[model samples]
Target: MQKKSIQNKDSLKRFVDKGINEKELSPFDPPDAYNPLNIETIPYEKMHPFLKELIDEHKNFAEVLSKFETALMNWKNNNWIFNDEIDIGLKQFFNFFDEKVPLHNQKEEKKLFPLLHKKLIEIGEHNSVDSSITGINLMEDEHLKVAQAVAIVFNFLELGSQLPDKRSREITFELAYEQGMAIIETMKLHIFREENILFPQAMKLLSKEKLDDFN
Candidate 1:
């Protein structure tokens, strides 16, 4: 079992190295795999208080993502050279993720999504094969993926900075860059889906009392 585990680790490392060295892994334009729901975004002024607060948080998170992207670009353009600006940007991004994302996700998963899940089922918005597969499920899955990507990026960046060899450091940093880009893109998409699709659906389907309960 230990030998198999070692082999698996080696395989994963090789796969990551190949991904960084051979091809572009940063772009996240999925071709028709994820179609946005045809709903319009409820204006911020008209959103439920709970949702308005979430949107405000989203705006703050977007700012952090923008800064992080700039820092990542600078790091890459400088041939993986680490700098104080880059360090600050990475720290801010990770800090926001650690501090805010969990609480936001908790509100959605625990307070909002359960109710929305039931409403989606009532309106036949769920998958035919599986009643549990609603928009909420997709959003929740993305939440988990975002957390995983953030951890991978953080670990790779830390590991790269501590590595003894230049080539090893470059490889790890390259992987970190790819994963970081994925985090930014995935998060932007997730927020869009929630604002335009899931939250609107919640407002439309859920009762005023149900919505008020969010407060």
Candidate 2:
């Protein structure tokens, strides 16, 4: 009985040691496929290259917006010690909107929307004998509204960058946070509508030839 008890104790100690070693191993040291950030977006399997490209761009914008939000949180948590950092992050977000987002949106507005609308009309899903309102018009209206809301956030950040005092910095950061969240909320819905509604309608309604042209 004593010998058996000793053996069981040794086995238990080994298990405990193994558990300790595993816990001590850096959780941050993960393989690339582990995806520590947990990127959660809609799965768009087997889409046209053009639509896929737009989806990828939207995903990139979301990531950048996430970073900007993190910067704002950090600045707020640390008594606004990182005011300049917030400005830097905000600039990155705005530049993405200015330099990249507009062109991506324009591609949809100029190429994707017109082509998709014509195809949807032919199929009689939109601009029909009974229903004249098209998905294209809805998306375009959303684009204008999203652009305006995003512009407000950008302007707030730009003005906040020139804040001269801690009080002003705090006040401006608070205002920017509210405006930024509103913009993100609206933009996220706009993106969802496009990805879920508009893009899918295009994929389903348009022919292989038309999709090839867009690509």
Q: Cα-based RMSD of the predictions, in order?
A: 10.0, 17.9
Model 1 lDDT tens row, 1-215: 11122112221111101132444221111122234434566788888888888889899999999999999999999899979998899899999999998998998999999998888778766655566666677778788878988999889988998999999999899989978876776677678767777788878888878878887
lDDT of 1 at 128: 52
lDDT of 2 by residue, 19-40 (tens): 3334331111112212212123
Q: Residue 22 in model 1: shift from native, Å?
A: 37
Against the true structure, candidate 2 reaches a TM-score of 0.66
- lDDT (Cα, 0-100) at 113 in candidate 1: 95
Q: Residue 202 of candidate 2: its Cα lDDT?
A: 70
Q: List ranges where model 1 is wrong by over 4 Å.
A: 1-37
- lDDT at position 178, candidate 2: 68
* Top candidate by TM-score: 1
Candidate 2: global Cα-lDDT? Answer: 0.63
